[model samples]
Target: MGNILSSHSPSPLSDANPSFHYLVPHTAYKVFINHRGKDTKQSLVSSVYHNLDNRGVKVFLDKMCLRPGQYIPQALICAIRSASVHVVILSPNYAESEWCLDELLLICRTGAPIVPVFWEIRPSDVRMENKNGVYAKAFRKHNKVGKFDSRTLEKWKEALRWVSLLQGFISEGEQGEMVEKITACVARYNEMASRQTI
Candidate 1:
């Protein structure tokens, strides 16, 4: 709930040496937000995080949960596995970052119910249907890098395609309405998760 570091500040893939001793210990979360920080962290991400927090939903947002010296990827993966629901905010530049793609892969692997928020983009774009779109361009750049093998790239693409097929909210600029719908979905899952633990 505080003005902690922005979630986009840490590029998990860029960190050459990932450590764990400095991580801030935390309790279990009900919702794990998998988002492109630059696209939504300041807007929809903050709104959704605060809204769910106000409603007593324990949310895991990197900006609020991560500290300066924590192992970003490990901590994030832990958060993803701990949550009951994952809200993936896919934006125009979502595929540009390897970190975001890795996070998406992890979220898909969790097998938890995902609430995909297609912000300023379509499901087809996310599914790599439009070769000229932002996602395709991003993937092209990644392919050029040679840092990721072909199989890893294919896995990421598959994850994107799979999530695009799920029922999710599309924000065609009406952010408030989108946030409310996402909040409702998250809260519903949180309630279900709470009940299962009893």
Candidate 2:
């Protein structure tokens, strides 16, 4: 992960109702985990969600849902609005999905701090610059990557590095350190929000 942007706000736990939209009395950070549904590992998501929840970090995950007919867009937008952090789990299949790109675009537009978790797929699989790149072509063709050129494969690695840095997912050895950094980042934001009330 590159430099993780620090929030100027206080902690979220200081508030009475720390729900995403409540203007949490303290600094409440709602994190939206964006990823390909199929790629979300039970152990990984469950562990992370449990850990964050236990630590009072509000997490938005698709697995925790209502009935099939519920209005997903409204709920998702609301969650995004309430969150201060957005985590994008990047994988080959991630860019293949229109929904993931929409979420990424929305989060990016919102100015929320984004954390990209690089999964099994290499970063090059998601470059946005080249018109024929996987990510670029997908967006251009309305999220389709079937006709991508083979020559661009090498260039995709650069795109992956860019995306990883843009989203703050560091190399393998940095994973544990990154988590600690993120935890502190969230804590700092919550603290800042808390001070606003003082």
- RMSD of candidates 1 onward, in order: 7.0, 10.5
Model 2 Cα lDDT, one tens digit per residue, 1-198: 222212211211112232435322222237777777776646444555666777887777767743364355545655666777777778656665645644555565567566677665445545554556555554455323434333233223333444566745533664456556555655555555456658
After superposing candidate 1 on the true structure, give the runs of residues whose Cα lies further than 4 Å from its correct spot.
1-23
The local lDDT score (0 to 100) that residue 86 gets in candidate 1 is 94
| Model 1 whole-model lDDT (C-alpha atoms) | 0.82
Q: List ranges where model 2 is wrong by over 4 Å.
A: 1-29, 65-69, 128-163, 170-198
- How much lDDT does candidate 2 score? 0.54
Among the numbered candidates, top TM-score falls to 1
**CA lDDT, every prediction?**
0.82, 0.54
Clashes of each: 0, 18
Local error of candidate 1 at residue 131 (angstroms):
1.2
lDDT of 1 by residue, 1-198 (tens): 112211222335425344546446645778999888899999999999999999988899887988776666667777888999999999998999888887887777677889999999999999888989999999999889877777667777878988899999988667788788889888998898789889
Q: What TM-score does each of the candidates earn?
A: 0.87, 0.60
